[model samples]
Target: MRPIRRLLVANRGEIAIRVFRTARRMGLETVAVFSEADAAAPHVMAADVAVGVGPAPVRESYLRPERILAAAKASGADAIHPGYGFLSENADFAEAVVAAGLIWVGPPPAAIRAMGLKDAAKALMQAAGVPVTPGYLGESQDAADLAREAGRIGFPVLIKAVAGGGGKGMRLVEEAAAFDAALASCRREAASSFGDDRVILETYVARPRHIEVQVFADSHGDAVHLFERDCSLQRRHQKVIEEAPAPGMDPATRAAVTEAAVRAAKAVAYEGAGTIEFIADASEGLRPDRIWFMEMNTRLQVEHPVTEAVTGLDLVEWQLRIAMGEPLPLAQAEIQLSGHAVEARLYAENPAAGFLPSTGPLNHLRLPKGVRVDSGVAEGGDVSPFYDPMIAKLIGHAETREAAIAAMAEACEGVEVWPVRTNAAFLANCLKAPDFIAGDIDTGFIARRLDALAAPRAPSAVALSAAAEAAVALAQDGDGPWGGGLAGFRVNGAADPAVRLFLDGKAMLGSPNGMSERSVLADADGHIVVFEGGEAIAFTQAAPGGLDESSGDGAIRSPMPGKVTAVAVEAGDVVEKGQLLMVLEAMKMEHSLTAPISGVVEAVLVSEGGQTTEGAVLARIVPT
Candidate 1:
């Protein structure tokens, strides 16, 4: 059992920062590896030492096992921590780290390999006496044979890639006629996502709830479960909001699930931090008999913070201790769950724009106080197109579930992100939704209420008034016409002061309040752009006579920098309103650009497989 003297985190962003914080508390120096794009990232600055791994692309940097090992060796780091993404679940990387004579702050490579494939992991779980969902794991790749298996599993079956997670390479077939197309699409996605085109079919549980138990084991074969987290709220198969001590879960159900998690761990001789995911049928309330083992995540989870909050434990610290041959810190019975906690991931995306990933500078970012914020980017930091768009996570905890939910809602509402759109308002609305508040959550909850959740939200009258007042105040005594120094001189006593401001090129007129109502001024902090009521409105002195000129033709432009994956139209093609013109892939998400009006496509400026920057016109349309 060798204690680690220095540790190198083979990851980037918030997860790296998270592990570094714990390593520091353990009196271990930390080294960080960064890509070219992240040279000035917050994680790099937080580390005691940093090494450049490679270029901006993850394939050339974070995913390169050789570069990571070399960085660790050059830094003299005795241990390496693979924080959640890139190489966290790569079994070969884990084995290579151990072979290099460095401690790996993770589970055994054998255990990771056992759980790497969902079908194999399910088979292992069933063999270990754990209840598993009914499925077919046969090796037959014939489409006809797979269809027959799907028929046996029944309609609404889930075709999932064996080596996939994060909702990628998964499809649900609700009817027989659509099975072939879904199968083909799923296979294509699987091949692209996991490099494996093989898939397994499972009976899809309607109205299911995702609950995972956090399990930890030490070198001595001792294992304990750190309660459970409810990750039922999701979009695109990725968790959006997670809570600890799942609401509406009874004592019996909790005990059964947690015990099953430990059993699964013991079967593989698991070590360090792992999560056993279970899908619970919630058509009826949560019942132990209805819950089935789905798969095991052989590494720390993104929602680990929620579990840590309720357990009053640092999971990262536990991982370090267990990796160093230490015994489990506490017995299963000694571990206790304290208060309830909820966490919301703040992403740089536009919920209303079909949740398109956004990339730009975080012009103004102010997280609400009185909550825990795990962030890897600072105000003015660029949300680049090279990595995940998650900016930070906000955690709120309280003695009761209701209070915790309320606190999370307040935190989301108070957050201020700008330039790059975010889902802060959407998250706040979800927390307060009638169904959500009553704990009526399931995997289908987001899809069922997506229209309401992603609806275009406008600023409140009060927010508009505040913005108007702030704009007038800034323009007052300033050089612009809206400023008081030049424009405040009223020609008549009967005329009220009016200031012209431009928001997204649209002119706005506003009036200042009387001195008695000027208290709202205190909330102003000189932000040229302010986020209020779920919308960001930028206030700039309008040009005299609104003298903006536009070209004769309507040019459909790309909203963000990305690659044009598809072009649906050519020159001289007639299009209808909202017709798909092109599709742009950015930040790992696809955004479809549509026609704003009926017109004839005069020219297609962008070719298929071409790249474009924000505001780059892809096509010119002449109104019919």
Candidate 2:
């Protein structure tokens, strides 16, 4: 066992900061690797030494094993920690780190390789006496072969990429007729995402709950389970919220699943932090017999904080200790789950706008003090297009699940983010929903209520009045009301002065949704973002009379900066309302542009692989 005197973090953002904090607490010097775009990132500033790897694109920087290794060597780092994303689970990168005579703070490369492919992992689990969903894991890629396999598995089967994750390269085929088209799309996405077009078929559970157990192992051949987390709240196969001690999980189910997880880890002689995910049938309420192994993430998870809250253990610290060849910190029988903890991922994306990823400067960011917030971006920082759009993670802990949910809702309502769209309101709504509050959750919960959850809500009277009061305050004094000495000034019997405001360029009459009430104003930045009763209302000062500033006539513009990946319509093509025109890939998610009216495509301004900015016209249509 070699001691790591200096540790280099081979990733960026919150995870980097998280690992660095633990390393510092353990009396180790830290180094950070950053891309050009993240030169001033919080992680870089927090580390003892910072090294620039390459350009902004992940392929040239974070995913490049050589650059990261060289950075470690240059900084004289004795060890390297691959935080959750980028090269964390890349077996080749882990092996390279070991080959460079540096300690790797993760699972063994052999274990990663064993669990990298979904089909092979499932087969391995089955061989280890772990239950798994009925599926086809054959090597045949022939379309006919897959269709036959799907038929035997029955309808509502899932066509998933063999080397896929994060919901990319996955599709649901509900019937035999749609098998071919779905397979082609799935293959294309899989190839684009994982560089592997091979796929496997599985029986889709009508109502599935995503449960995963955190397991830790040491080089001394000891491993222990750290309970379970429910990650069922998701959008587009990406986790939105996670909570520890899964609601509605019985002791029997938990024991059986956690035991299986530890077995899976011991089977591979695993070490460090890893998660073994399973899918539970929630239609009949979390039965041990209905649970099936899903996948094993051979690295720390994004929602590790929730596990820490319940276990009262810092997972990153444990990771550092285990990497130094320490035995398991706590035996499985000794470790006990204390309370309930919930975590919500705050992201720079608009749930109402088809969850399109948003990129811009964070003009205002205010998080309540009560919750545990892990964030890398500060106010005035930019959420760039070069990486994931996660802004922060808010964690709430309480003795009961209900109290934890309530605390999370309060945190969501109290957070103040502006300019860049976020799903904060949607998260609050989820926590407040009757079904969710009752612990009736499944993987499909968000999809079933997306309309209500993502729908734009009318601003409450208090919210509108607050914005107008803010505008009035800003108008009275250029700097602020306090600086101008305009406190407690009210004219007697004067006709209530009207303050006109515009929300996202739409006119608001300064009337509250229910009642009109004058209130003290907070300093505004010519823009006001108010979170009231778990809803976000945003507006900026507009010219008198709400002057129309439409960009153009019949122009279909890109809503966010991205590269065009596909153009389905030509310049002269006639299209119906909602007809596909093009696809824009931004922040690793695809947004489809559709026709706004039945019209002829007058011009296609952007071609496939062309980069375009927000509000840039991608096409022009002539109304027919």
Per-candidate TM-scores read 0.89, 0.93
Error of 1 at 483 (Å): 14
> What digit string (tens of lDDT, one per residue) describes model 1 on residues 27-135?
9999999999999999999999999999997889999999999999899999999998789999999999999999999999999999999988988998999999988
The digit string of per-residue lDDT tens for model 2 on 1-624 reads 688899999999999998999899989999999999999999999999999999998888998899999999999999999998789889999999999999999999999999989999998898898898888999999999999999999999999988888777788898999999789878877776677999999899999999999999999989999999999998878898899999999999999999999999988889999999999999999989999998899999999999999999999989998998888888888888999999999999988888888898876666667889999898878999989999999999999999999999989877666667788888999888999989899999999999998887888766676566556555656655522112223332333455677776677766322233322324344455555644457566764353232423678989999888888999889999888888788887777788888889999998888999998988899988
Clashing pairs in 1: 475-483, 476-484, 477-484, 477-485
Question: Model 2 — TM-score against the truth?
Answer: 0.93
Q: C-alpha displacement of 408 in model 2, angstroms?
A: 0.7
Off by more than 4 A, model 1: 479-509, 514-528, 539-557, 563-584, 590-611, 617-624
Candidate 2 Cα errors over 4 Å, as ranges? 479-495, 504-507, 511-526, 533-536, 540-552
Error of 1 at 436 (Å): 1.1
